[model samples]
Structures are given as structure tokens and as C-alpha cells.
Target: MVSHERENHFVISTRSYQADVCGKHLITHKPAIHECYGKGCDRMFPTISGMFIHLESGTCPSKITLKDVNAVVAMYTHHNSIIHSDYNKSLAAMLNREDPPDGFPFHCPGFTPGSLCGKRFELFSGLLQHCESRACNHTFGQDDGGLLSFLHKVLYSESALFKLGRLKANVYSRIELVFPEVLRDGEQEHLEALLILLQMLFRKLLDIIENVQSRLKAAISKHINYQILGLSLGHPSNLDAITGRRGDLSALAGEYASITGNEGRIAGPERMNTSEVFVWNIDTGECQLLHLFLEETTAVFEILSLETQPQ
Candidate 1:
């Protein structure tokens, strides 16, 4: 039998079959949310078994055995239901058009599942959850190389942090492909800042991967238990090389490679077939006027260019 009096943490009280002594504040099946539903009112309740009672019975006893309680805690924390919930809510809001366009992505455009804006929110939610778990919020928006710097370093190490980099690239490519047009000055700047932070995080992950890979090489050569080491020595470079050969693969390394500039020339040169032409005749007769207009325009442009040519 195990019991805790801490208000912040849950306690499990055990009684064999049905024998127990009562203590003050030690209420059984206390008629609160958990009493009524076997779930905590606050949302910090952890454990599948703890929740299992909530699922099976309308109410769970307040006092649970220490063994059952620990089992619940291990499963719940390992599964990370709380963090998943937070991330899901963020993504759902973006996907469902519930979030107002605020600092970044200034344009909602509409709810397209495969759109850049949607993808950004999705990846952002994931990254945000990871940051929260690591308690990385304190450094956000701080000047003099604080949180922002930390995030930047994390993003830039993408080559090493295989998973983070892969996820970021996926999101980045989706954005670049969908929103390949000029953005407002403010929006553009905001996107740049966001990319910087993402890049920093990615870079850190890469460094970790590099270290892991070095260890992996040594482990394999020396017949070490790589699995026991629990390191993330990654094959990101090899993976990248292989994936790069695929026809569907795009150059996702470049930031905003598809974000348009002032002149509106596409950021990446897209090969287009120009061999096909369509001609229409207004009166089923030779329409020489349109051709003449084109010729005159071309000649005038040429004359202007030649006269204004420098040296």
C-alpha cells in the first residue's frame, strides 16, 4: 500500500480486498471530478491504469495501491498524452481555421490541408511541444543570445539532428511550394526570423547526430552494444544522399527558396515546355495586324536598348 499527502501529486492508497482504516483528509471515492469520474480536475493526472478506472467505472476510488499508481504513472508519462494533447490542439486550431492570423503567416488564405500555412502550424506545434518538455520557453524573445539564440543553434544543426531536420525540411518544402509568391515586407521579415529559429534547432540536432555517428562507428568496429548505449548516432548524410536521388525530392535546404521577391521571377528556375503554341484567326483570314504590332514593339525595344547601351 502507498499513500501521498501532496496536493500537487497524486497518492495511491492500497487496501487488501476490503480492509482499511480511515484518516482525516483521506476520503474514499471523494465526490469530486475524480471521485465522480476517476480523473483529476486539473489535467495533470498521469497513468493509463489510473485513467483505466476512469474509463471502466464512472468513478474511481481516491485511494489506489502504490503498485497500481506507479504502473499508471510509468505508462502515462511514457506515452506523453498531455504533450500530445497540447500539440493536437494547436494543430487542430490551425487546420480548423480557428486561429486568427497574428504575428506570422499573416494570411490564413483558407483551410487547405496540404498548404504551407497549415504545414507551418503543424510543425510549429510539434517543435513547441518539444521545447515545452525541455522548458525552453524562458529564452524566447530574449536579446543578447538567450532563448532565440538557443533555438537558432538548435535549428541550424539539422544535418546532425536527423529527425528535426527532416521534419523541418518537410514543412519548409510544403510552404515554399504552396506560397511561392511575394509576401508583404513585415510578413517576409517575420518568416525569416521564424526560419532562423528553426534552423538553429535543426543545427543542434545535427551536432548530436554527428556525435552519435562517430560513436556508432567505433561501436560497430569494436563489437560494442550500440543499442545499450542508447545514442542517436545517425546516418543523416547517407539518408540525405539516397533521398536526394528521388524524382520527387526538392532542394529543401534553401530557406524561402520559393518565396518570391519584388520582381516576381520564380525563386527556383522551373523548366517549362515552350514548344506548343495556339493561334486564333478572328475572320478565318490572315490576321497580319497582330503580327505587325509584335514586330513593331520588338523593333522599338531593340532601338531603345541599342541607343541606351553603355560601351
Candidate 2:
């Protein structure tokens, strides 16, 4: 084969010469059908995946990058299986480096029946062994460099950190998260108990909030008019001291508005410089406290109730 290649042939058919060049044929034996829509790159390929390889290999005259292709692909929800976003920046940086770090993230993004998918490995080689042994079915490495192209783009652009493409996950996948081993030696055991207790507290807080919301909802349904009987002489001068102390109060006010036929929505929250949001205000000395009550549906004197009872 070397001697045959030593002498150049003058073949009449350009196609035959290329076919028998006995060299690397980047193009497949399949028919040319996948036409690239890239600028100045109207060349066709046997398959769409081949065209992607061409684009990502940085050989196309169009100069369209892998990140460019990935960004566009992510906009299409149906193609999510072939794309990823909000990826692990640390892993991407390691992959883009010439001499990669010793450790892998060691997470398998798979969950097949009885498979060692979604399992974390203690060592980089352990991860390789897991994939090689068909645990998670070689989930990370089986994409024909389709997955590596994602990280390789980091060499050219920083946006590569959050976006990856040509990787597969289960059709019904959870929100992709990078649950790293953020603790050092001995930290896990010490912190895990406190973390568990914190989680329980969070559950209790959630339950209390749920109960509060339920009671508020029930109160609104009862159609009872609420009246502030009167204020003590020593009552805090401003509503900020008592009424608006809680962060949820504004949201509660919005709920009140929504139930009382007020359709206004708050905008320009970014402009707020103060802690309290006052719907209406006057000179500091002229302020007064009022109460809210349901207008009786049957009463003729549904006179807007603005009873300011100050003691």
C-alpha cells in the first residue's frame, strides 16, 4: 500500500481517485443529504451528526462554533436530550486544560434499573471502571466525542461553562444539579447531623407557613369585617414598626387587593430605597391608622369604610 501511494496516479474520474486514495475518508459511504445551513458552508453530509462533527472540529469555512450551535439547539425544547445547560464549570475547566486534574466529578447522570447510575465514585479511576463495566451503560463516554466537544469549546469561549451539548440523560430527568463533595475529611460526619436537623426545621417552617396561608384564606372567605378598635397612646408612630415588620406582609397586602377587586400590580421594585412600601402617605405628623372590613353585600350604605379610630 505504501509503494502504491509513493507514485501518484492520473485518474480521469475525480470520484474514483478520491474513493481509492486509500487515505482517511472523513465522509461516510452514506449518501450526501445533510446540508449545512452555515454561512458559506453549504457542504452536505451523510448525517446530521456528521455535520455537527464538522462544525465542532473547527474545519468549516463558515467559522460557526460549537457553542453557537449548542446555544441554538438549546432553544428547542425537544432537542434537550442532545444538549445541556447550567453545567459544571469546574469540570469544563479541567477538561479544557492540557494537563487535566487528577480527580473527576465522579457523578453518573443515569438511573437505569439495578444500575450503578447516579452513584458517586471515590476516585477518578473508579468512575472509569464503573462506566467500562457497563454500569450506567457507559453513559458519559458513549457519545462518540459528542460529549467532549462540549468541554473542548471552553478553550475558545467562556460561555462554555454553563452550556454543554450532545449528552444524554433519562427522558424523565430531574433538574440537573452538581452535588459536589463540598466538605473535606471529617467534615461530613460532623456537619451531616446538623444538616439533618436544619432540614427538619425547614420542614416545620414550611408547615407553619402553610398553616398561616390556610388561615388567611379561610379568614377571607368568612366575609367578616375587621375593625381596628383603637390605638394605644404609646403605639408605635409608624406602621413600619408593627404592620410591615414581616417580609410576607407586602405579599399579604397584594392578596388583600386581589380579593377586594384591586387589579394593580407593583412595578419598579428596584427603585425602592426604603424597607417599607407605603401605598399612601402624608407628612410624618399627619399619619393615621385605619382598619379594613367587608362591605355588606345587602347594605345600601356600603359607604367606603375609612374609620380612623385613634386614642
TM-score of 1: 0.19
Assess every candidate by TM-score.
0.19, 0.22
Over the stretch 1-311, how does candidate 1's per-residue lDDT look in tens digits?
Answer: 24443353475545442211332123333333322212122322232223333422323222212222222221221223222333433332432223332332211112233442222222222333222232222112325344233322221121122222223232223122112254444544444444344334334334333344453345333221222111223344444433222211122223212332222222222342112211122222222232232232232222222222354
Clashes of each: 28, 0
lDDT of 2 by residue, 55-126 (tens): 655465544444444443332223234322223343333332213223433455555567635655433334
What is the Cα-based lDDT of residue 247 in candidate 2?
Answer: 33
Q: What CA RMSD would you report for each candidate?
A: 24.8, 24.7
